[model samples]
Target: MPFSVPPYRLSQAIRDKCKRLHVFVQAFTLPSCWYPHRIRILAPHPVRNKCGNAVRIKTPKTGSAVPTLADVARHANVSTATVSRCLNSPDQVVGETRKRVLKAVQDLGYAPNFSARALAAKRTKTIGAVIPTMDNSIFARGIQAFQEELGRHGFTLLIASSAYREDLEEEQIRTLAARGADALLLIGYHRNRAVYDMLTARNLPVLVAWAYHADAPQMSIGFDNVTAMAGLARLAIGKGHRRLGFISAPGATNDRARDRVAGVRRAMREAGLRDTDLSLVETQYGIETGEAAFREIMTSATPPTVVLCGNDVLAVGALRAAKEMGLRVPQDVSITGFDDIELAMLAEPPLTTVHVPHREMGRRAAGMLVQILTGQGRPDNVELKTDIRIRQTLGPPPPER
Candidate 1:
């Protein structure tokens, strides 16, 4: 739960309270009895939360308590409704009166119940995202960017990982919707038709990310995966690395992985390489799985001159396996990856990979969803770009050993 509450939220809450306090002090003078030094804000007491709807404000320094809106009103020398207005809609209150109400709030440490405030608002100001996995750094930076932008707009972000399982994602989606999420963010457009239909039927807007297509249904905010990967494959081919091996995540559910593999195949075909020439292995999305697959490929009678991974995570695994086998990267066998995650840069050879604008994509996705919800824009797809960052991990095929 502590991890769920980011520092930005706490800072924002305090800053808002402080602004209100400054206004209250300027609006009018408070009697010495209501001075900040003598007053202390108390946590809500059960009696105040129960029958008769009493409010509780304890001043530990003075050994006294003032409970209820009536107490705040009396302390501020204003009507009860005025006290409410100052707390709820200070902008509508006369400056001096608003300041007076804020002073009372600060002096007594009067904080309203969260559930009561939500009921009055009629909307929860929360957005939910169901990503594939949260344990890795692949989505961490991007999700953090999205959350910070959402915070700027006074909205909370709730995240749940489906662990690459659609059934779990569907369940989480329903739960978040039931909990009153105004919008949803999904990964890729490969989900079941029924899931799409459900959101359509309920009129809930969803924006898909991490992969994009021109014609397929949902709105997208990501780069063209096939094209991005194809570019890198062509470059590898141009470097004269004829033999190739592909390490990928399961293609059954991952459009991104499928696209990358397709891109490599297309490149190989264009170079007159037969289908059987390139060894392809689909593995789980983990470093250890990647290492195993890498080792498996390397042991073949005619090992590949290069290995192309579906993502940086897999490439890093391949690199590790290469190291353990006493193989030199780019010299003994070249390797490349996609996603350009932070781990890519930290790799020993500094991975030569495709750099997707993850943070930029995240910020844009949140903005577009907000625009659609506010009726300012339609759910249109926005495609971003990717760059091929050639680095130490890739090079021309080595001379025969």
Candidate 2:
């Protein structure tokens, strides 16, 4: 009988390797030149296979056929079933037999098929993430922590960037799920209605990060955006910054940005300043945009004594604008930022910003997802503390003002 093949694409691990090799993949059958299975052709040149399904193609440089499970079974003088059990569930096989099968596996350089194992266990041990963007370092440290935690639990992570676009994010989410993600880690909770419904229907474990909404019915792991930034606002206000301005990434799709702005407004309102007294400039997330928005807010009939940025990326830009405009930070004007990323410290005058516990959040988020996946715990949210990092960028308003 002809060899049967499962449907759909190669696993993320295989595709990642293929990307580094710059190999082109196509649906084709194994040729007489190689094995008798259907596989994707990752050929520098080109070859064909009559097999109906797809597998990653990494032909040996020596032009030898890739080793298969049967090869290991033969080398160990055992049945394929024994080799399979030794690889997948060693406790089910005798110790001596397991050792023999493993040694054979090592000698033959055999890798148990990922798809086959996933099918048998109904778990891929793979986690997926769809982040807003990868261009900046804001999410880098946290994501690194998340990957490290997942690695410790013997899971692989695959990430896709959405560039802050909701439609693209939804697409990436579906693609990740279709590609065998056991659970997903997503940013704040402003997703489409159908998204949660779909994940629920599929019985996938999904966690929202970067914002904690305990009252909202979503599993999240992060600090409360409103309360965290409110603390910073109060600190800035306490320093005598009566004239305040806000430079933010677009709040249309981001509840985080909106919440931060709301926090500042709340502080001002409580301090007896009308919300209209505050200047709000919404821009894309970039250094250039930050500089331009800062200029616009500063050149007003009466400039703000301090400017609050939605996050560190914009704060970095505002700092640049301050220097270029011949204004000394915290002297001529105070500047505050959120998400105390690495750039916050690197600012000429180190930024006095809100310090988010990114690594801890990532680790906790991973632990929660793993618990849900492995049946050790149910879906839940974890609230982390956000600290006010007092540094050079925040001070009382100008002596004259």
Candidate 3:
């Protein structure tokens, strides 16, 4: 009896079998009661069984028709093992044979299965990086440089953003590990102890970037946030701005933010300023948040002479707010920011900020991870320097108010 099934419903195996048998299968609606809708198998010459029902054919299962390493080997007239070596370790194969295999690969559009290759080599040659946020350009340049460096070393980078949430960051780290990341680059040293334990159990090499401490247990390649911010704060104080207002991101889960606040406080204490002199407003990192924080600080009974922002994003926000409030920068109230990102210079009055070597940090971070992974040597914690860029936005307090 004929069976009714759509042409597309037929598996590839059946199609290949029909192609080999020189038969074509088509679906058609039949008026016969025995077969209302049936697939008609047509051959060069019609042949029927005793009951006149089309004979059912069976074909052995086979792999997908997509080109494989074996197909490339066959086309290049080389052994499968030789094809594998040519694709993976090209230097292992002779120049002439390598050229031939590569040609076959291109002609057949053959793509090696990376999953299978990774399984065989016991390495993925892939690195995963988890950052605090991707909403801003703060980490953009650094990550781009890191990726370029990784590419130069014949590795790939996979990035995930945690939106500054510790729990989500932990989840992404575990997911990356489960996905067989050969290594990982984390933003900071602060995380659940279980995260470190899991990495140790997996024997994964982990590198911490963005913030650094000499006594940290994990390998770190970054600047000291406290020292960098302290240097900037001291510069503002030296300019004769006694009253300082700081707008910072929440420091509860952010070591960088916490250190920056500490740095400001240290600078104020050294400058003989009272605790009441500095007014701090903690908020998320964004232009609008910075603007709102600045407005809040300015409305206080005794607002600061200068507003020190956690990063350029917040600083830019403060600048925008100052403009709308008819406040002249450095005249009405001075403002400063960290992370001399491009926005700092582009501000109405170029921002006076701390210039972090973002690209160098990223490139060096990648090199450090590669070194540890390849067993070249374990690197020491690197403390890069941050310089203060004095622009138009920061100066002496406005003529004693």
lDDT of 1 by residue, 192-269 (tens): 888888888878888899888999678889988889988999999999988899998899988888998899988988
lDDT score at residue 274, model 2, on the 0-100 scale: 83
Among the numbered candidates, top TM-score falls to 3
Q: After superposition, how far is residue 289 of candidate 2 from its true place, in Å?
A: 1.0
User: Which stretches in model 3 have alpha-carbon errors above 4 Å?
Assistant: 1-106
- Please provide the root mean square deviation of candidate 2 (C-alpha atoms, Å): 14.0
How much lDDT does each candidate structure score?
A: 0.82, 0.84, 0.86
Model with the higher lDDT, candidate 2 or 3: 3
For model 3 the local lDDT of residue 44 reads 22
Query: How far off is residue 186 in model 3, in Å?
Result: 0.6
> What tens digits encode model 3's per-residue C-alpha lDDT throughout 1-401?
33266545667676555444433231232223231122234222242334555544334345668898889999999999999787655667899999999999999999988888898989898999999999777699999999988876767899999999999999999999999999999998889999999999999999999988989989888899999999988988998988899999999999999999999999989999888898999999999999999999999999899999999999999999999999999899999999988899899899999999999999999999888877798888898888999899988888753
Clashes counted in candidate 3 amount to 0
- Evaluate residue 331 in candidate 3 and report its C-alpha lDDT on the 0 to 100 scale: 90
What TM-score, over all chains together, does every model reach? 0.74, 0.76, 0.79
Model 3 TM: 0.79
